[model samples]
Target: MKTIGVIGGMSWESSTEYYRLLNRHAKARLGGHHNARSLMLTVDFAPIEANQRAGNWTALGDQLADAARQLERGGADLVILATNTMHRVYESIEQAIDVPFLHIADPTGNALRAAGITRVGLLGTRYTMEQTFYTGRLSERYDLETLIPNEAERADVHRIIYDELCHGNVNDASRAVYQRVIDELAARGAQAVILGCTEITLLIKPEDSALPVFDTTALHAQAAVDWAIEPV
Candidate 1:
């Protein structure tokens, strides 16, 4: 199996999920005593978060590129960036490493296409929701149309992500808010909802949404496992 390199800890909460899902996927695919052959280089998110809020993506890109290079040097055959927001700098990381970089969006996009989902709701950091890097890729590559929560709801989603979810705090009140948001999106003609933030799955699950839930963290990790164990 190829070694999966992971750039993680943009928030350790979601990074833990990536690790769990990767091993779970590996075990489910390979049966007894099996797990993913992987290496995770976890960064300190304090400075990363500071840079994100300050709009210093150049520094973030350089930091992530260095992480990717470290993983490559450690014998990782492929790389996965564990956070959806950090993917804003995916191109720099991709360019910095020789290994195949598994973009967090591609797996979700492919699954949405196979399920015939044309229009989808997106929930993530304000940066991810408002910026072109993510939604633009979905439209350009997957022929998918993206919808997001209204401005107020977008603020709620972004706040919950950074303040609560990042700290591993899951409150029922927050979940209810997300449920209402999903219902609102469904009302707006969203065919499915992309849990575009990695930490979103910690708050909302498939059962809680008004539409189908595409959890990017799970899809990304599962895809990494599929790639790692592909026939040589």
Candidate 2:
């Protein structure tokens, strides 16, 4: 198996999920006491969060780039950025490493396409919801129409991600609020709902919404597993 590198800890809660899922899927597929050949370089979340809040991506990108180089140097064959919002720096981070950085957006978009989803609703952190960096890539690169919740609902979703899920507290009440948002999105012509926050799939599931749900975390993890097991 190829070594998969992880640029993680935007919130280690979701990062932990990435590691677990990678191992779970790897063992299931290869059928042994196998775990993913992995290298994880976890960044300090406080500074990264502060940088995002201040709109200073230069330092954040530099930090991630440095981590990518380290993961490569540590014998990682492929890299995966373990957070959705932090993928804002994906381009620069990709340039910093020679190994493949499996974009969190690509596999999710591909999964949506494979499921026949054309228009989709997205729930994520404020930066991810409002920015063109992520949604633009899905729309322009993958030809998917992305619909974000309105400012009010967006704030609620963002709060749930940062103040709740990121902190490792999954609240049932939060899930109810998101369920309403998902219904509204389906009414707005969304064929599916994309959990753009890696931590969200932990709170809500497809059963919570009337439409199909594509989990960014699981799709990204599965894609990484597939790539890791491929012939070197």
Candidate 3:
């Protein structure tokens, strides 16, 4: 198996999910005692979060690129950025690495297309929702239409992500708010909801939504496993 490098800790809460899912998928695929061949370079989320809040993407990109380089030096064959919002700086990381950088969106987009889903409701950080990096890639690559919650709902989602979920505080009230947002999106003709934030799966699951729910973290980790174990 090829080594899968992880740039993680954009909040250790969700990075833990990536670590667990990667091993679970690997064990299920290869059976018995098998586990993913992986390397991880976890960053301190405090400074990264500060940069994000201040919109200092250049510094964030520099930090992530350094992480990718460290993974490459550690002999990783490919890399996965374990958080969705951090993928805004994916290109910088990619440019800094020789190995393949698996984009979290590619697997999600492919899964949606395979399921014949054309319209999806996305829930993530405000940057992911309002910006072009993620939604634009899905549209350009898969011909998918992405819908985000309205301004007020977007604020709620973003706040819950940073303040609650990233800190590992999952509240019942926050989950209810997310369900309402999903319901509203479904009413607006969203065929499925994309849990675009990696931390979202901590609160919402497939059974929580009326529409089909796609968890990007699981999908992204599974894709990494697939690539690592593919026959050469």
Candidate 4:
């Protein structure tokens, strides 16, 4: 198995899921107590969050690039940024590492395409929703149409992610709020909802929404495993 390097702990909450899913999927696929060969570099999210709030993407990119470099030095064959929002710095991270930097959006787009999902609803941090880095890639690469909640709903979604979900606090009220947002997106012609935030899967499940839910976390992890186990 190839070593999968992870840039994680944008919030340890979601990073934990990435680690767990990687191991679980590997074990299931390989059988007989097999597990993933992985390396993880977890950073302090406080400063990263502060920089994000301040719109200091240059500094954020530098921080993430440093982490990716560390993973590469540690013998990682492929790197993954565990958070969706942090993928804004993907280019810098890619440049910092000699290994393959598997983009989170690529697998999500591929999964959506394989499912014949042409339009989908996106829920993530405000930066991810408002910026072109993510949605633009999806449109350009997969011919997918992305729909985001309106300003008001977007604020709520962002709040719930940072304030509650990142802290590992799951509230029924928050789930209800997300459900309403999903309903609005479906009304707007979304065939499925993309859980754009890595922590989002902790709250919303496929059964939670009326439409099919595309989970970027699972898709990204699965893609890594597929790459790791591919015939040489």
Candidate 5:
């Protein structure tokens, strides 16, 4: 198995899910008590969050690039950033390391395409929702149309993500709020909803949404397993 290097802990809540899903899928694929060959460099999210709030993306990118370099030096075969929002620095991290950097969006986009989903709803931090980095990639690479919540709903989604989900606080009320947003997105003609934020999987599930659900964290982990077991 190839080693999967992870840049994690932008709110270790979702990072923990990445770890669990990676190992679990690896075992499921290989059987016989097999697990992923992996290394994780988890950073403190406090300063990272502060930097994001301050719009210090360059410094944040540099910090994550350093993390990717550390993982590569530690002998990782390929690298993955465990958070969706931190993917704002995807280019920097990709350039920092020699190994393949598995982008979080690729697997999700592939799955969406395989399912014949052309239009999708996205729920993530405001940066991910409003920025061109993520949605533009989907449009340009996958021919997918991305729709997001309205401004007020976007604020609520962002708040629930940082204030509650990041801290491991998953409330039924917040789930209801997310369901409402998903319904609106479906009404807007979204064929499926991308749980664009990694933490969102904790609150919303396949059965809870008005549209089909695509969890990026799960898809990314499964893709890592596929990469690990593929013949070189």
Candidate 6:
């Protein structure tokens, strides 16, 4: 078995999910008590969020890359960033670490492609939806086109993420908001939707969507667990 490295605590909300899903998947795969062998580097979220507010990603990237390298030193075979927004500096993090970084976009793109979907709607942090790194990686690297909610709708998306999800509050009203986003995406010709933020699966699921939904967090973590448990 290989050790999976997790670069988490971007909000601790989604990172917690990553930790749980990895273990649950490993247990299901290997046995009742089986769990993944892992190394975790949890960075402070306050400062990262502050950096996001200030648009000072250089320092943030430096900090995240350092964490990645430390995880490698701690014996991680692969690194999972655990949050979609943090992937803005993914290339820098990858260059700093020795282990292969499991890109959230790859499995997602592969899954969407396998399902033969050409266009997908995306919902996440304003940064994840509006920013280039995440969506660009999916488009440029994976050859997938992503449709994001319009400008005014994005504030609502950001609110749902921070005001509710970041605090672990899942409500029916929030689900309704997400459902509306999904519907709007479908109306606009999106064949599917991607939950680009890790914590979003807690709010809206495929069950609530008319279109296919890609839960990037789940896909990314599942791949990590598979790598962690595969025989060396």
* TM-scores for all predictions: 0.99, 0.97, 0.99, 0.98, 0.98, 0.95
| lDDT by residue for model 2 (1-232), tens | 9999998897899999999999999999998799999989988899888899999998888999999999999999999999988889888898998888899999998988888888999999999999999899999888999999999999999998889998999998999999999989989999999999999988998787787889999999999999999943
lDDT of 1 by residue, 28-78 (tens): 999999999999999999999999989999999999999999999999999
Candidate 4, 8-88: lDDT as tens digits: 997899999999999989998999999889999999999999999999999999999999999999999999999999899
Per-residue lDDT of candidate 5, residues 1-232 (tens digit): 8899999898799999999999899889989899899999999999999999999999999999999999999999999999889899999998988899989999999999999999999999999999989999999999999999999999999999999999999999999999999999999999999998999999999998889999999999999878978924
What TM-score does prediction 2 earn?
Answer: 0.97
Which should have the higher lDDT, number 5 or number 6?
5
lDDT of 6 by residue, 1-232 (tens): 7889999887788888888888888988899788888888889888998899899989988999999989888888888898888888888998998778888888898888899888889998988898888888778866888899998889999988988898889999989988888889999999999998998988887788898888998899888888777732
lDDT of the candidates, in the order given? 0.95, 0.91, 0.96, 0.94, 0.94, 0.87
| Superposition error at 4 for model 3 (Å) | 0.6
Tell me how far the alpha carbon of residue 202 in candidate 5 is from the true structure, in angstroms, after superposition: 0.7
Candidate 1 accuracy as TM-score: 0.99
Minimum summed lDDT over a 10-residue window in model 2 is located at: 204-213
**Tell me, what's the RMSD of every candidate?**
0.9, 1.1, 0.8, 0.9, 0.9, 1.5
lDDT winner between candidates 1 and 5: 1
Report the C-alpha displacement of residue 8, candidate 6, in angstroms: 1.0
The 10-residue segment of model 5 with minimum total lDDT is 223-232
TM-score of 5: 0.98
Worst 10 residues of 4 by lDDT: 223-232
Off by over 4 Å in 5: none
Model 2, CA-based lDDT: 0.91
